[model samples]
Target: MFRKKSVLTFLKAQVAAFLGGITDYGVMILLTEIFKLHFTFSILISGTVGAIINFSINRFWVFKNQSNYSSHINSQLFKFALVVLGSISLKSFGTLIFQKLFQIDYRIGRLITDLFVSYGFNYPLIKYWVFRINEKQNAIQSN
Candidate 1:
């Protein structure tokens, strides 16, 4: 059941996310630990980098659409910005809830942000809605 193309697409997305995460971690470390940037700013920079990487990989490899690159890129970027906005909101809420309500550490709050904001809700929404280049057309053609 493991077709090559599907497997490759999945692997490419996973690799992109992993590399993006590493890139994000580096930026966070530099901004937070070295440059003494605010936690929010560091998170924004790291998350933006990761989102760019994810968008690039998904557009070129996973979707493989034949649309105009410029237009596709613009729309994808817009959608990504929305997703990032949602992620940041969720992260801030998670941090407040964890620290104030549960007396949890901010690191755990970050973990909550990572899971709910980025991985869980955002991934599927971006995959199916935000970056869905050929969605309606594909549906029409298939029918």
Candidate 2:
């Protein structure tokens, strides 16, 4: 069973992702359409920016309620960086493949790719591994 805290944390994480995605997607569009950069290249640039925003939000707001996280900020950041690297790689390849397969716009393909990467790849890692919100810990906290 999941605790209410877990549910709340999930919601908060979604919010942070949304905020970060907006910045990332916006930059991607601007770079691709306005600056005439390749979509994939734009994604690489914007993804890094978005990761920074997401990390800050997750550190300060989404997972802020946990004890000792502030003290372990450096470690949390290291883990989060690893997750973001994977997340960005997945997004880059996924969007390219999705666009080619579906013959859709890169923007639309990226949106679809982000949905999967953020939920399937990003969320679980950020929750359990990056932030160290393990099941055992949640169970004890709930009790």
Candidate 3:
């Protein structure tokens, strides 16, 4: 059963991601242009900051998972961290490959890489694994 709620939730998550992306890009620009930081290091820090924002919004707002945060937050955070670490690796390498092999601009390459990583990897893993509804909760809600 394809619920409309699921679609709406996804849309909201996308919006949250878009906002987080702006934060990420802003930090990268600030570090690189204002502070003269290296591009790769800027990306590393900015991406981690952005992932923190994305995780907060997705956990509280987008997914609306009612799990006991006090008891489960650490576990959830660990899983989310794993996913973000993988995403960071994918994005960093993907952007480098696109720029070097295809002669794309770094910004453009990053955009493309972000799109692919967010949709192809992040969304699915976050939805099904990180914020998955517990079976007991699901059964209770169903009944």
Which candidate's TM-score is highest? 3
Which rank order by TM-score, best down to worst?
Answer: 3, 2, 1
Error of 2 at 124 (Å): 0.3
User: By the TM-score metric, which is better: model 1 or model 3?
Assistant: 3
lDDT of each: 0.69, 0.86, 0.86
Compose the digit string of candidate 2's lDDT tens values, residues 1-143: 34986799899999999999999999999999999998989999999899999988987798763456465777887888899888888888988997888798898899999999999999999977887756675566567
User: Is candidate 1 or 2 superior in TM-score?
Assistant: 2
Cα error, candidate 3, residue 60 (Å): 0.8
Backbone clashes (count) for model 2: 0
* Model 2 steric clash pairs: none
Candidates 1 and 3 compared by lDDT, better number: 3
Q: In candidate 3, how many clashes are counted? A: 0
Instruction: Count clashing residue pairs per candidate.
Output: 0, 0, 0
Stretches off by above 4 angstroms in model 2 are 65-71, 133-143
lDDT of 1 at 105: 69
